[model samples]
Structures are given as C-alpha cells and as structure tokens.
Target chain A: MNEDKKIGILDEKTYSNQIHLIGRVGSALLLMFMLGIPFVIGTVYDCMPKFSWLIQPSIALLAMMGPTSVSEVLGYAPVLGSGNYIAFITGNIMNLKLPAAISAHALAGVQPNTPEGDAVGTMAIAISSIITVIICAIGVLVFIPMQPILTSAAFKTASNYLVHALMGSMILNTFGKGKGKTVIKNKLMLPLVAIAMSVAGVLLIPKFSSYQGYAMLVAIVITIGWAYLLYKKGVVKVVNRDEK
Target chain B: MSYLDIANSGLTYTLVAVALSVMLGLCVVFYVKTRKRALELGISKEVLNKVNRSTILFTIVPSLTIVVGLFAMSAMIGTAWSWFRLSVVGSVSYELMAAQTTVASLDIADTATADGSVFVAVMFVMSIGALVGPTLSAILTKPVTQNLQKAGAQNNGFSPIMNACFMLAIMSVIIPIRVSTGGLVGLMVILTAVLLSMLIDKIASKGVAWLGQFNMPICLLVGMLSSLVWAKLLG
Candidate 1:
C-alpha cells in the first residue's frame, strides 16, 4: 500500500497543479508586500513623495535596470523552475538563491525543469530564504562592531572575487562531467565563444562599456542561437529517458 | 523632524516590522504547502533533508556578503531603512545606486543633509523600479515552465542542453567582470577554482561522496585564499 501511494504521488498532473497553485498565491502575496512597504513608509512618516519628485528618479532607475530585470526573469525561470516565485520575492536571485537551488537539485540527483527537481528546488529556496533573513537580522544587531572588520580591504577583495570563484567552479564541474566528444563539444564550445566575444566587446567597444546593462541579455541570445543551430544540425540529440 | 531622526523613527521601525512579518508569513505558507505537496508526491525524507542541509550550507557565504553590504548602506541611510530595504527587495549595488541617483537629482550633495522628502522619494523610486523582476516572474513563470516541460517531453535531451546554455550565459557575463577588474589576480583565482572543482570531481568519482556536495564552497574558499597570495606576489 505504501509503495502504491508513493507511485501515485509521482503523477505529473497532480504535482504540476499543486506547484502552480502555490506559485500563484505566493507571488500575489509577495507583490502586495512589495508595494506595501513604500505605502507604509509614506503614510507613517507623512512624507508621501510628490508626483513630480518621483518622475526623474523613476525614469533614471528604470532606464538603467528595466531591461536587465526583464531578461533576468526570462533567463532564470526555466532554470529555477518552481523556485522562481519564492526566489524573486526574497531577492538575491543571482548571488544566493539560484546557487542554493542548483546545489540542492544536484545534491538530490535531480535535473532542473522536472517535477522532482522543482520540488527540491522549491524546498532549497525556502530554507535559503529563512537562513538569509536570520543572518541579515543578526548582522543588523551586531553591525556597529562588525562594520570595521567587514569593510576592511582584505575582506572586500575576497568578497569581490567570491562570485567569480563560485561561477568558475560551477562551469568546470559541469564541463568536466561530459561523457563523450559530442557532449563535450556541444556543451563547451558556445560558452567559450560567448565569453571571448564579451571580453572583446568590453575591451574594444567603448559604447559596449556603457551598455553593460544589456551584456548578459546579449550573451544569452548568442548562446541560445548557437545551441539551436547545433540542435538543427543533429549535433544536439534529445534523449528520451521515459522510453527506456 | 530631521531626516536622520525620521529615518530612525519609531514609524520606520514599525514599517520594518510589518514588512518582516509579511515576508515571514509568506515563507511559512509556502513552506507548509511545498512540504505537504512533496510528501503527498512520495519524496523520501532522506532526500529532502539532504537538500535542506546542503542549501543552508551553500547560503552562508553569500548571505554574509549581503550583510556586509547592509552595513555600508546603513551608514548612509540609517539602520531602519537600510535594514528594511536589504531585507526585502534591494540588493547592495541597486540600493546604493538608487539612493545616490535620488539624492543627486535633488541636487543634494549627500544623504546627511537630505530631508524627509528626499528619503521618501528615494524609497519610492527604489521600490517601484524593483517591481519588474518579481512581477514578471510571478505572471510568467508558470507559462514558461510549462513550455519548457512540453519541449522536454518531446525531447528529454533538449531540457538539459537548454539548462546548460542558460548557466553558461550567466557565467560568461560574470567571468569578464572579474577578469576586467581584478586583472591578473582575478584570472588566477578563477583558474584556481575551476581546477580545484575539476580535481574534486575526479576524486569524488573514486568514492569520496561527501566532497561532491562541498566542491563549490571549498573551491570558493581556495579561490579567495589564492587571491590574497597572488595579490601579495604581484604587488
């Protein structure tokens, strides 16, 4: 009976429905909270921003961040799966939440964009969000004393390199696990080309430096195009596991 | 009241408290729902526990970096507002940029002499500007996931390749920034991390199971440590 129940739970339709329900409700609540903060601050302080005061700053910020925000949602949704709703609200998607979700999926031996992987990713994101709130709360309490140490030059440099280290290691870990020439070629070539192009754009084109805001979007498009071409050429085969 | 006083006022604290409560409540709701769903789906407790532990460990360093950022921001905007922003929608770079842009637009030299009006404007702009990502994700994630699933259903290999490409795109953007700024030292650190991770993977295949879970974090530490050494040698 227990085994039968376990098998029943793996039903794709039921799992997807539940995830959809949770994501919709969670996102609606989060959107409310996002708007509520400013409203609360404005009302409580009795310093509601004038309509005019909001215009220039809003334009400036939107001009800089608008495209990046759109691209982030589009890019991360597929990788993050159901965790996207949770992660978007908690913020820090790039630096913290996404990595945690990926690590959780890897640890559980689940692949991304699947029902099982979605559950694992969601759980991981929840735990990470809880930990982040706790850490930030603690940091606020002891911030005065910790300020000097945290801001020290040595620590700053380390923190700066941290993301690069994390990302580089992740890439190598994925690349090193390739099983054949086809997998290696398909997986490695496009990214290497994209990186080279981005580096050149940064160095050679002064205009590209100003448009660093769109660099990630541009890189993603290039890689996706390359991957699609490979797929069309039959170099990228889609293996159907269920058939086996 | 003065801007700093307003920034540190009881009202501001109340705002933080309210926002924190809402965030916590949502987390609990999501947690309960996700767990119930997972159990009903028949996922083993062992797998769930492993993922939970690994995620908590993975979050520590990055969360601390955010804390470090919060400290800097608090010095500029007062503890209450800084805490509220960073705890919610704001990141270090975005919050700082938003604050600076707001102040500059008003022609204020610094946040020190800025009034409540400036504070309100800054907060408003920051909050509104950040709405795009979460809003779009909330509305689009389901449709997007369904499409990806449909694509995968037709060809399982397509999903994995798409996933790999997405990761590569992100890394390609990040690698250049580090290389551009850190120069030789940054390159050395990144190369060290890549090598360390590859080496760990090789060892893990030989039966060191625990190391596989920790390969990224360990590589991060080694890369940071190597940067210090490189900095000294290059100087």
Candidate 2:
C-alpha cells in the first residue's frame, strides 16, 4: 500500500554507512562532553547540586524538552539525514544549519531526498558548524570590546526579528517554487494544511508557546498525513520525479 | 571561588577549547570525506565551489546572531560556558530557562551570586535536559534517513512530497507562533520577509546569478530590517 515501493537506482552507491558510524559515535562522545563540562565544574568547585533539588527542574525540563526531542527528530530527519549528527550537535538547526544545508542544495541545483543532496547537505552543515565555532571563539575573545554594540536596544530588537525574518524567506524556498521544479503537483496542499493547523493551534491552544512542541508534532502528522492522502488520491502528481 | 571566577576559570576554558577543537576537527574530516564522495558521484568541481562560496556568505549573519545571543547569555552564564553551550545544542531561550529553573529549585536570587552547586546544577540541567533531541537524532537519524531514501528510491513520487511536508510541518508551527506572539512588529516582519523573499526569487529567476545564491541571507537581512521600520512607525 505504500506508494514508495523500492525501485532501481542501480548506479547510485549508498553513502549512509560510514556517515552513520561517525555520526553515532561522534554524538555519543559529544554527549559525554556535554555531561563532562558540568561534572568537571562541579568537581573543581565541589558544588554539585543535591539530588533532591534536581527533581523539580528535571520534571519541568522533561515536560518541555521531551516532546521537542521527538518532534525535532521526526521532522528534521527526513531533510537532514547523516547531517543530523553534526547539525544536532551544533544546535542551531532551524536558523543556521538547516538553512545552510537547504541553501547549498538549492544553489547546486540538486534535489533533496537523494544521495547527492544528502552529501551536499552534510558538507554545508560541516562548513557552517566550523564557521560557527570559529565565530563563537572570536566573539568570546572580543566579548568585552563588543559589549556595547551587542547589547544595544536596537540590536536586541533586531535580534528578536531574526527568526521571523529567516523563516519567512525560507518559506518560499521550501514551499513555493524557489528553484526549477519540485515533485508536487498540488504544491499548495501541505502549506494550506500547515497554516490551517496553525490557525487551529492559535484558536485552540491558549498558551501556544509553551505547547509549541506538542503542536509541532501534531502538525507534522496532520500535514504529512494530508499530503499522503492527496498523493493516494492522485490529487498531487509527481513531476520530474526520477527515483534513479 | 566566585561564580564569575568559576565560570571563567582556566579549567573551564581549557575544557571548552578541547571539546570545540574536537568538534571542529570532526567537521574537517566529515567535509573532506563527503567532498571526495561528492566528486565520485560526479558533482562538478565548479558546483562544489559554488556551494562553498554560497555557504560561507549565507552563514555569517546567522552565526553572528548566535554570538549576539552569546553576548547576552555570557553575562549570565559567563563567556566560556556561553560559548561552549551555544556551540552545542544551546539556545538563549533554553539557557535562560535552564538557569532560572536551576535558581528556582535552589531558592537562589540570581546566577551571579549562586553557589558553585547552583552553577554546576545549571550546567547539568542545560545539557542533560536538552539531550533528548541530539540523542534521538544519533540513534534514529540513520534508519530514518535510509527509510526515506528507500521510499524515494521507489518510482513513486511520495518521497519528495514527504520531504516537503516535513519542512512544512516545522515552519507551520514555528512561524505562526512567532507571528501571533510578536504582535505588530512580528506580523510586519513576517510579512515583509515573505514579500522580500518572493521579490528576490523573482529577480533571481531573471538571471541575476549571484543574487540567487545569496537570496536567503538577503531576505533575512531585509526581513530583520523591516522590523526596525515597524518599530519606529509604532513609536
């Protein structure tokens, strides 16, 4: 019943094996680093918090982050692939890494969900991650001198708009016809579904921000489910869709 | 030692440096490996060059914005910790929230004078709590990506549609929430960005080769600039 029945892309060699091995191991190591930092600080200062104190904040953190973890993996995996490892590690997925990968693919005139696309995505992320680390280091070195420009009200206000602005421009790139052609025929279906879901979210969820993660998961299922349904119904046709 | 002193300690700085160096080193390895593979796949050198150029240009503003976050958060979390955290799954919002939660649980007034226990606890909460996403990604990304690839490999067009939907799913939730909460400036910023992106795309389609490559950053800048206009108008 799945329309995505495997076909012949015989010429293409799979690139997932090595990338996954590195990705999994690297992520595990990075997690250790994350934990290690605290442990080291605690040891040096001998100031580790009591176990009893952790219970309250852990619960609160779990409530917010649990859904987010699941949602991010589900939504981002399809686009990011092995790049997920570094992208997740680097931790600026929506704003920096994702846009970087997507933009790289777009510039190269490559299609997503393909081997070439995945490689380019990974490459872009690596480049961006490297750049980010370098920039952060530089920022730290100059933190004192740049304090005024960085903390200015105008700068702070503009910073608030960064995500909004970035996402808006990104919509056209992702949803609309930013490049030559896309696979979907009825391109509007998913976006409309997504918008409707958002409107419903706004009307229904009084505290939308706190529940954004849950809403995100719900939206993913609804929008993808809607797209799949339309695909099954033949309402959305695939064009230039060469699986090979 | 004082909170600031502990946060800025040489030990903290050294640990952060080593971790980041490892990460940076890994990026180099991955990039080199992926680059070789890309060439093997017959992607032209010229195109790869374009990707490099485009990526560097596109990344600057976003990365600097993160530093802006770093600047704000460093005051609270300290420079080294802020750098390490932002470079690894750390967001200003998450960092701020984690700090507040840690303080609240410890019954502290602020991060500056909080005990070493409080600082360490804040560190733990920040990392361990946010591990869900990256941890899941590490375990599940390969299989998920393979499945999507397999599905796309099938002659059917469902896979690409699936990919598009995933992005839509994310954008749907994130964009609306921002617009709704952002009020007038939020609304204007989003609208301006959408319009500007569309305009740029139109121009790119007309053969401005360089413009097409840099469209995202351009739209983002213009979009952020539009917020200032809205802010001034309202004032």
Clashing residue pairs, backbone N/CA/C < 3 A, model 2? A47-B117
User: iRMS of each prediction in angstroms?
Assistant: 2.6, 2.1
lDDT of 2 at B69: 85
Worst 10 residues of 1 chain B by lDDT: B150-159
TM-score of each: 0.87, 0.91
- Specify the CAPRI tier of model 2: medium
Considering just the first chain, candidate 1 attains a TM-score of 0.76
Q: Which run of 10 residues does model 1 chain A get worst, by summed lDDT? A: A176-185
Error of 1 at B7 (Å): 1.2
Candidate 1 lDDT for residue A211: 50
Error of 1 at B178 (Å): 3.5
Q: What's chain A's TM-score in each predicted model?
A: 0.76, 0.83
* Two-chain complex of model 1, DockQ on C-alpha atoms against the true structure: 0.59
For candidate 1, the per-residue lDDT at B197 reads: 82
